[model samples]
Target: MLNTGLLELHSDCQNCFGLCCAALPFAASSDFAIDKNAGQPCPNLRNDFRCGIHTELRAKGFRGCTVYDCFGAGQKVSNLTYGGRDWLQAPETAGQMFEVFPVMRQLHELLWYLREALAFRGAESLHDSLKLMLEQTLMLTTLSPEELLKLEVHIHRAEVNELLLRASELARSTARGQLNPAPKRQKNYGRGADLIGAKLRQADLRCVSLRGAYLIAADLSGADLRHADLIGADLRDTNLSGADLRDSLFLTQAQLQAAKGDLAAQLPGSLQYPEHWSVKL
Candidate 1:
């Protein structure tokens, strides 16, 4: 396992150009107050690159913005890639910068998981492979804006995902193996299966795959999710009080931010309880 921690995956907005508020388009809904086009700066963005309503996002109907995670890609693009170039000052460079932000974000997100996979005690044998992929993904984040825009990120993601799966399986197997006389686990769910609002409290979900699962508003309070893979799982409004997710695979801070959880939700050491867990938008 590499010595690097996941702290770098946390977004540092002070060094960013509000790329997410500019580069990503959003439809007006519960998450956003108005429809905004891609490449357009959000109206709430201040000239200094800070959210105008950062402290009042949830109350202002922009709860989505509060949870948006760039995985440190914003600062990487703003400082490392562009050398502190302010997009507003260089109109000619704005387009390329905006285009490169999402690509860099994806690479960083992959790097985040790859780094976590390396730390899984049960995946020791896969550390070398995970390290290589992590380095490769990190290198991709350093490409020039033009090159970044042209990268076949989806193809790269597919390759990295294969390794991630192997690592997840190894760790999950070890986790479940530790559970002597384990309880029954649901086996029918697949990627993106609809489980919205389903009552799953106290379910034995260890060593299962909830990848890309639509678990919106699901009642998962007190669920045992040890080593369950949660990659791409939609956790918005999911009740997670008392859920055991300390070893859950590939769970990101963004996922936790989207879900409804409390201090009782056992999270991986690298994660924190979101401050707005009880705030209703």
Candidate 2:
């Protein structure tokens, strides 16, 4: 029921808590050559609460810092939940702030998907279903911190899955049931090509043209998409988890944050690795 076209439903990080910097941890790896623990501030975090090395994070050996997105949870939790108080100015709120960060992050992730689900005209048949889910997700935002943190996300996600499958069925009908059908050979695309819900996991989609493509809910997890051209692409809810997106051109930070990516994922030079992943530590 929110305005879906303008991405208005998503978070604006500039107005956020800088929660991504404070809540997540980092380690010495290709992405970040440090061993900062969870909930600790980055050394480069500035007095004004911005990353001091944001522009040169890669050269500074913090590559993962360039690719991370909190889906606007950072700003909302920082400003709304804490009443515009930064942790440095109110040190006593540290524990509570960290605890609330992940809850808001999870809520924002659902919002990203719900917003995407509402945007697909191909899924208009399932709009009512998506509308209900969106309403439920919006209600979660108003819950107390304890309730929000204790919330079971998989239950709501399961409900969304049923509707998503039906939406895929409707979208696929237009694609003639061929998911990820090879694009034309000469750097071009035909009018009304459908790629919605296609399984592109680990696919080699380098240097390809995807103008105005419908990529809603497409599983791009683990795909090597270096240098791919994605101009005017509809990428709502397309998974990029575990995908190698290094050097992918013209992909915006807003787009990357709108999709899901875990620790196993690779990102552009601008983002960093997620500190919350439970790898074999």
Candidate 3:
């Protein structure tokens, strides 16, 4: 298996420009009660790039802000990539930074899963391909600012399709036969089942009905969860590292985003990495 420990690298956020304050948007929801547009600095953002009402964001109707994470993307681009520059003084650099930020974020997210995939013993068969992909992705980070901004990630994704498919097979195989399909039963009955601390590592749980199940602190590492239905499931502190959650049903953006996963972590394909994690190594 590939070593994923090295992919846990992070940037010092204190020196960052608080890009998350500017890059992300908010909608009126349980987490965020206000609507903010992209590229607009959050009202609570101070001149020093700290949230003025950080401690009271939840009380002040901005609970979403407290849970949001840039996955260290804010720091990586705001600090190392740009040498601590900001759009404030250098307005001309704003466009470039904005374009590069998302790209870098995606790369970092990919790094998270690639690293995690390598760490899974069940994925050993595809280690060589994983290594190549990881190295190539590492090289992308070194591309020129213009090149990085203009990178055609779709092409790279296409190139790795085979590897991803193979890795999925390997990862899925590890979870063989753990979960049985339940009869098409009434929804209200399964509202709150106790699944905490279940030894469900590497289990194939795709398309399983787990709505409103108490999955708190479940050992779900390396589980194949593509297209599974997980609406209203309590997933606090769940160990979902390296688990495939792409296309999983009923997983709202708010729930998945609020859930915690390490950099070198994986989520359903439908989910995006929380901005706070630096890289998914």
Candidate 4:
């Protein structure tokens, strides 16, 4: 099982310096209400570093903020990297801090995935390698702002992803055997498949690799998606009512927010149901 303590690595906005609301620039689009430049405090960001309209973000056309997760990067940079000094308190260091935040966020995201991969008992063969990579990634998160700015996070991510993919293959292959003991062949669920508007209601997708699949507006109501690798899957407007996704891999809060689900839809413990979901149950 995943170490429950690792959950602390997730975003805790209360402990952050509102980096996401300030450092990341967003264009005025369907997802955001306004175009904001990088390093500029969001108009809705309060003096206390909290969103002024957090509760009504989606209703107020700031749905992008509702989906953003920094994986505890904000607090790590705010407290540890800068000794709890905020941008306003020390203007000289603000630029460097802002630049470091995104780098830390990417590293933390990789840590999240590696930690999840460590929980798979079926992937015991890759555990040692995963642990080593996790340690290396965690170390990167602790680097100084200057060091972080110099780091190439994508290169490190590529190295870690190799082990994660192997682990996923092992776990999914094992889950496939356990879930379907029969020798019946399954269709190739292609990577990056353009599954837009595909009707997949009640589909047996257990242990399938749906990585990078375009599931936009797909009708997946009541689909059995347990153990499916959903990394980078575009779930916008996908109907997941009554679907089982308890063991889905690499599924993130942003993807869930972009999709629609109900109380009857089973999600993994790491993810929460979006409040905007229309169906009660």
Q: Quantify how close model 1 is to the true structure by its C-alpha RMSD in Å.
A: 2.4
Ranking by lDDT: 1, 4, 3, 2
- Per-model lDDT: 0.88, 0.65, 0.66, 0.87
Score every model by TM-score. Answer: 0.94, 0.62, 0.61, 0.93
By lDDT, the better pick of 2 and 4 is 4
Best of the two (1, 2) by lDDT? 1
Instruction: Please give the lDDT score at residue 20 for candidate 1.
Output: 95
Best by TM-score: 1
- How many residue pairs in model 4 have overlapping backbones? 0
Candidate 2 per-residue C-alpha lDDT over 53-118 given as tens digits, one digit per residue, 9 for 90 to 100? 877786888867755656677776776667898888889888778878887776666666665546
Per-residue alpha-carbon lDDT of candidate 1 for residues 4-104, written as tens digits (9 for 90 to 100): 53236779998899999898999999999999999999999999999999999989999898778999999989988899988998979999999999999
> Could you give candidate 3's per-residue lDDT for residues 1-281 as a string of tens digits?
33343243343347677677777778887767678887778888887888888667767887677655454566767765787778787878877777777777667656655655575545797898898899887677656669987899878866765565456455544533333553233223254778887778888777565757888778887776664557557776577777778745445444554555655665555356765345442
Candidate 3's C-alpha runs over 4 A off are: 1-12, 158-162, 175-281
Clashes of each: 0, 11, 19, 0
lDDT of 3: 0.66
lDDT at residue 129 of model 3 (Cα atoms) = 85
Off by over 4 Å in 1: 1-7, 278-281
